[model samples]
Target: MTASRLPQFSGKTGRPELMVILGSTLTVIAILGIVTFLLIREHAGAKETATRSATTIAQLIDADVLRTVELYDMTLQGLIAAAQRDDLRQVSPQIRHLVLFDRSTTARFKGDILLLDKHGEVLADSSLIEPRPGNFADRDYFQAHVTNTGSGMYISRPFKPRCDCEDSNEWRISFSRRIASSTGEFLGVAVASMRLTYFDQLFNSLYIGSDSTLNIIDDAGILLAQKPYLEHDSIGKSFATRPNVVRILREGSGSFESVSSIDGRQRLYTFSRVGNLPLTVIVALSGNDVFAAWRRTALVISGATGVLCIGLLWLSWLLCRELRLRHQAEQELAQLAATDSLTGVANRRILDLTLRHEWFRAQRSGQPLSVLMIDADHFKAFNDRHGHQGGDEALRTIAKVIAANVRRPADLVARYGGEEFSVILAETDSTGARQIAEKIRMAVQQLPKTEGDELPMTVSIGISTWTTQTDVTLEQLLFAADKALYQAKEQGRNRVVAGS
Candidate 1:
């Protein structure tokens, strides 16, 4: 058979394989895209939940801190009021102390309450009946009160006592009221101190995450207190220049996400100013803690998605391989069905199909189509001399020679029957067909003799061509070729003849 007749088999295998690969790839991409989109949305939700939680915590701190400041302010006001009483001077020292320090005892984390003179001299103290001789002329609260007579209650930066007192190293902040005359003349200051541990106690009651922190800073960016302090000495240190602190103070009251300058870990910082006070409370929740659960879920989902997509692709590959194998098997079956087993060329069925197909094609295109009928010479006598196997071998050799001479891609060679073969040459005229038939006849006649064979092999070929002017049908065309083949056998053996 010519290569052109068998072109369709090679091309059919790839279409199924390509379709399978394309479909599998598109499925994998869609799965990944959908998974990625869902994971992104889930991540956003985690962040939003963390933000809301931080905001709630910050609000709680703000409310608590504001209430505490109000208590301290009321205490300072009461102390100032009692100090200006003229009749209090005539009372006993114990009674005067009781009246002046009346509201101070109700304050939580109270350190000391002091009445100072205009020169910042301690006039009376809550810890002492007469008062300590400590001078507070340079204290931030005292200087602030002295500098502005109309200043409202003043809250000082975090500080440690300047004396050798037992708790002198403890951090504290002071709240003071300016003691003034009715004419607004500065008289002195009444100040109260609160331990910074108050913030620790308050923060400990809240359940922020293990890696997160709660913080309080004064308006000056001075670190007042922190829960589970990141830096032991961070208290009383001014973080005014730190980027995160600067943003917190600048925005005054809001929330943001940033990397912590202390540890370089990301955090969600939710902050709010304590009412109108010069204090801000910050709830810094660790990003890892906030998203840990979400990360775990995403990891599991991503792994499963990866496996699913890979499995799908693997299955697709297996299916494509199966389809390729099946197609190859089908092609092999089709080849066997159309081929002569002995000659290894197309069988009679294929010859008839080709003739009919080409007959119509030639009729439509007005092109000449030729058929060559070939017969092995004296096959019956040769078979009796050399056995059936030898006769079959000679027939195979003759079919090969006929196929060799008909080499055009648009031509076909097939076994027409036992010891008879056929060839179809598309668009060939009578002369061309006869020339090919003579070539096939000579090729078979020149075959090498077998070791025990009495005579060499030979064949008779007959040519029949259909042109635009020929009115013969497909059956008549084959009959004419067969008849011409008989005529070639009768005239002489091993010769070529053309049909009328």
Candidate 2:
């Protein structure tokens, strides 16, 4: 015989929402951390690129200026040699003027040559019909050359030309060197002037960014030139008091972030000193431009992560739903497995299980356990007369009456097979079992026959009781009840008989 199976489960509630929320929270935190790291890495990479570009641009400008100044210095050296070697004072004025001012007047860069005396008095001029009367003692280039008498070139800050100019009146910077005698006595200053357009035009070909800037400042924090070109410029402004200038002065070359003193926008500043010329080139890129690409990437990543989290939550919901349905299905299957398909009572499987368990319980408690085996009498003859469908109806009606008779919670009524049914009554002795069987017999006898040709309805019940003194096995109890049922059928039916 099969044993009873009743599925059980814990009645506590599940926390799928909390679990899903916890998982999504961790995922969001991880994504944020990755996004943060990527932003920082991109910022650093962009800063490095700006630094290299600025340093390269500054060196290139320094080289170009150096070459341009050297070219004009050669012209001055020629003039100085002419005065020393060729006795340039003995040459005709017209030939000397043509020789000195030809390139200066024709060149696009506006390179002007000037000769200044020891006291910084103008001796000659290239872009002039005649030497203009001007005192140059206060000029930085002139003073530097006269005092040092150096072989190298001296560059001055960008300023307006200190002369009457009929040509383009653009600002210019001076490059000067000392002219000395064979005895090393400083005689005059040889100077070459270059317009500010030279540096500004160089930047015109570059495409840094909309919010980008380029500045050329001296070691003393004096503004030399900048682009895009400024009108009514701050060319002469000295940055000696500015905080950024102090930083630029400390480091020869590096990159940093700071707010612009000019416009107050925070920017990435890449700076470098210009070729030992005491001129620093600073490239400032707005913070927005530098982080624009990274921001876009972060946006895409965030959107994708949000979608993924939604998908994960949906998956979690689906799983919880599936688990609930599975539990319901499992409970239904267990009930079906233990119940009779035809009459909806506990089947033989459950009856046998309850009988065995109650047998042991009765033995332990010194209480009585009773079993009643019931059968519809002459059921085969009834089916033959009224048809099998009528037989099924009679069996259902009798099973219902039997169930009604066994009323206690510890009592179980089961369909054994065909027209046979059984009842398990725990803590019930022979007298109580006989009373229940008699009641079942009287109830089944009263069922109104549904078919015209049906035989009279009736039941035969065989009762078995177990107590502490009865050393009977569960199988022996069932066998004894079955024997009593056979004997009742043999004798008259519709009666109750107790088994030994």
Per model, state how many residue pairs clash. Answer: 0, 0
* Tens digits of per-residue lDDT for model 1, 241-299: 99999998999987778999998999988898888889888899999899899999999
Top model number, TM-score: 1
My TM-score estimates for the predictions, one after another, are 0.74, 0.56
Which segments of candidate 1 are over 4 A away from where they belong? Answer: 2-53, 76-102, 113-155, 176-191, 218-222, 238-261, 264-271, 276-278, 286-328, 354-370, 403-411, 426-442, 452-456, 462-500
Model 1 poorest ten-residue lDDT run: 2-11
- Predicted candidate 2 versus true structure: per-residue lDDT over 1-500, tens digit per residue: 11132212234356555565677668767876886787678767876776677667666767776666556657766656554545556777777776655445433475667878888887777866478788888988877776785677777887776546564467787777788887889888877777777777877766678888888888788877777643356787788888888998898788889998777878888787766676787777777787777678768877886787678767777776776677677667777878887777888777777777777788779898888899999889888987888888788788778877877767788899999999888898899999989988988787776557454599998988888888888888889899889889988998999998
Candidate 2 residue runs with Cα over 4 Å from true position: 1-24, 46-56, 98-108, 163-169, 229-232, 310-500
Instruction: Score candidate 1 by TM-score against the native.
Output: 0.74
